[model samples]
Target: DGGGVRGLSSLLILENLMHRLSPEKDILPCNVFRLIGGTSTGGIIAIMLGRLGMSVKDCITAYHSLSRDIFDGPWRPKAWQTSKKVLGLTGDAELRSRRLEEAICHIIARYLPAEEKSALFGEEEIDPCKTPICRVFVVATQQSNGRRVILRNYPIPYEASRDMTIVEACLATSAAPFVFAPLTAGPEGCRETYIDGGLGNNNPVAIVLQESRLLWPRQSVKSLVSIGTGARVPTEVKQNLMSLAKKVAEMIVDAANEARDFESNIRLTEPSIHSVYFRLDVAESMARIGLAEWRMLGAIAQRTRSWIFENHDLLNRCVVTLGGILLNCLCITLRYLSKC
Candidate 1:
């Protein structure tokens, strides 16, 4: 059923199937990963799954989203052809660029399972021609170490992008590409195929699955997945999302325990579209993670900062906008509280 694209990424359809087709079925045993493709549902489902020791490979990477030719790479076919381009791959621009990105994907691929190549770009049946907003963000992850790693910028091969250093990327980019977890309330069964991709839509189901981390999916598991595909522009709504994301990031600095690494401490994978997209919804995001609510966490000292520096970026460099930060913080606090 999960072919490579948008494979079973729909929570709504899944729930519908569960509710109408066979409400008595339990999917928890399937080891089946579902991407909620949103804020609230996906996020919370991941939270619960984390407690179960299941690892989520999130599709919604922080600041990455590109239609790379992931197949058999000489690499950077276009970036290399351009006058201005990335450096240091030892070949011509195209060869270098292609090799570079391919190398990167390869490097990360090493740590990931063979099945999670497009963790975020999980694939879907959505119509790519949709008139709605099409998103391809740099997928971000909330590792078990309390870090939000930008999947694309991971430094196994080299430590920088064409624009800046890894550190800079982490700081600046962490604020934008938000992570999402999907979930569902009431549901039912579905056809052998469900979660149909809307044609002329940017909301690719693959991206949604990638975002949901339903199959042991992580926070926005692999790449930046699209939320939906529609022509209607609710400008006010878009502005609100930007504002909300920004505010959550600002509050993150003082809200958590010692900063986390790219690998979040509590890793989780949400299942189903309804669950995944629901978590991403701003209201649900806030209500479930409580990242919007600022509390005094007693600023972690500069020594901690220096420790990070001393490690030459080896120790911890992960950061979640505000949502992951607060979630990790509360988890950290609870850990100590229990120990005490």
Candidate 2:
């Protein structure tokens, strides 16, 4: 789901779902889903929708602008940076980290009110349990150690300190190696560097499930929707060390296979949950689009639209099920109001 520019596909799918859910007016995902989590580019999307309370259409537009602003320029790595890339060392990225930070800041400023903007983007720590809106979390990997950190807008069951700001969380999660420089931020003494979480936990469905259990120990999940950018095509590696290393690196960063394997495992272990679990992904056409192909937005949108059309029945079922849940919640709220 962290496929650089291919994030358009994920947004397109979400747009369709949101439109189907409320054909009349705009409905934000923050008001619908109790918990949302994603990695890398998906993490950015999660923040826009779940944390910022952005409508699907507005989020899609912001994503387009962000993609163009970030990827429109040419990237010519320095000689030393090229060598570092080949040797698997951290070096200068293809794009400047400042560009990404600025773009995200622009979006935050555009969407948030004046009174609330500073608090969300400032260095002040945010306790997820104290957030008034829906619970949200984004995954980012520690640069020093390969540990996965769950940057949450809600409480984790454990005793983890809330030391990160929302802006820092976004930048840290979106710092894909070789594409964007790793982000270094925090208080003076405890500053830490972070890169994209896709290298380890790309799909993030497992993380959502795990954290959901910790957040609500006795409750059962009624619906879990996992949307993907698209399926990746497998490539044959040459019989050489360099080619093998490159191939291994690609596999380690890619999440398509991991998503498929997890879905398969869910089907095998908990077939009964199939009725509640929904996975939507573009199966074909996207295999050829590279992750950094920002110019291929039109193509990605077309492919995702076609996939949605072909799977109308599944989408309908998902909409109906979620609508039922929404209606039930509304009824409970209405009953409480009547009692009051």
Candidate 3:
């Protein structure tokens, strides 16, 4: 749950599978899945895929382009550009956060048609009818109630303003403390500030499952897949915030596991794949940021590749078993008829 680029690994794994399954560039099989939910970096990916309806390949490329801006500093104002700053102040954390949010919104806008953007952004809530994907949710916590806020295309509650922008929602979900400032939604005085939803619900499998149940109450979810960056145990204990962060990490892992098990127990059919990388550590080290991104992403690709192979094998075995059962049933019926 450490706020780093490692979370992108989830998308990488999904992209790898799509690449192997089809050689086609712009077409992907993700349309089979109805609802999409994510937190932090994953939340950004979800907005791109589930909200904007961009192909997986395009999403991957767009993320790659934004990664440098996100990880490095992309919001630095040019020395001559005084208007970009507040009272000649530059390098402010909040300003940079806003810039990054704008960059992301720009990326989201680029993928959508001109007609769609006006409808999607012009309103307080996205017009779900205009979106190519049915439902998209990005998790963010309500600062006041400590409620896990699932930001959807749907309208906000009656008390809150109807004009909660898409850019604001995503920035709130992805904002990591110390890295980015907490974001506010709704009007001043009554506005709620939100932090990273990962603190409340890191893996958003439950949201997707809840939607599925609503859509098809009598049927079980056919498959539920989750991808996570690897977790690492604290090597040496530190006091205060660092110590709290470690404890929170442990809590997140436990909660995520419990959520996964809970889903499995209730579902008529079990999920096929749930991958968590416990070996990789992105949160532990803050320095050498560039190197960390490379190593973590490299490990994710290698590990995800193995998962892809294993799942492919499992699918093949299922096909063979079904074929054999069908053949045996046909042969038995033919012999009984001949004897009669």
Index of the highest-lDDT prediction: 2
- Better-scoring candidate (lDDT), 1 or 2: 2
In candidate 1, how many Å is residue 170 off?
A: 18
Question: Which candidate leads in TM-score?
Answer: 2
In candidate 3, what are the lDDT values of residues 1-340, reduced to their tens digit? 2235655555665665445444455333235345667786677777777777777767767766566565553334433332332233334546647766877878867876776542222235443333333456677777677788777654433433234566776788876544457888776777778977777577777666675665457764344555555444334555655455544444543334545465555554443322211112222223222211433555555555565565675434333433333344346446655655
**Lowest summed lDDT window (length 10), candidate 2:** 118-127
**Relative to the unseen true structure, what is the C-alpha lDDT of residue 299 in candidate 3, on a scale of 0 to 100?**
55
The ten-residue window of minimal lDDT in model 1 covers 191-200
Evaluate residue 166 in candidate 3 and report its C-alpha lDDT on the 0 to 100 scale. 65
Clashing pairs in 3: 230-277
lDDT for 222 in candidate 2 is 78
Enumerate clash totals for all models, in the order shown: 120, 2, 1
Candidate 1's C-alpha runs over 4 A off are: 1-14, 29-31, 34-41, 49-340
- The residue pairs in collision within model 2 are 128-153, 128-154
lDDT of 2 by residue, 59-130 (tens): 889888888887776555545444456676643353556777888888888887766743333233444334
TM-score for candidate 1: 0.20
Taking all chains together, each candidate's TM-score versus the true structure is 0.20, 0.88, 0.67
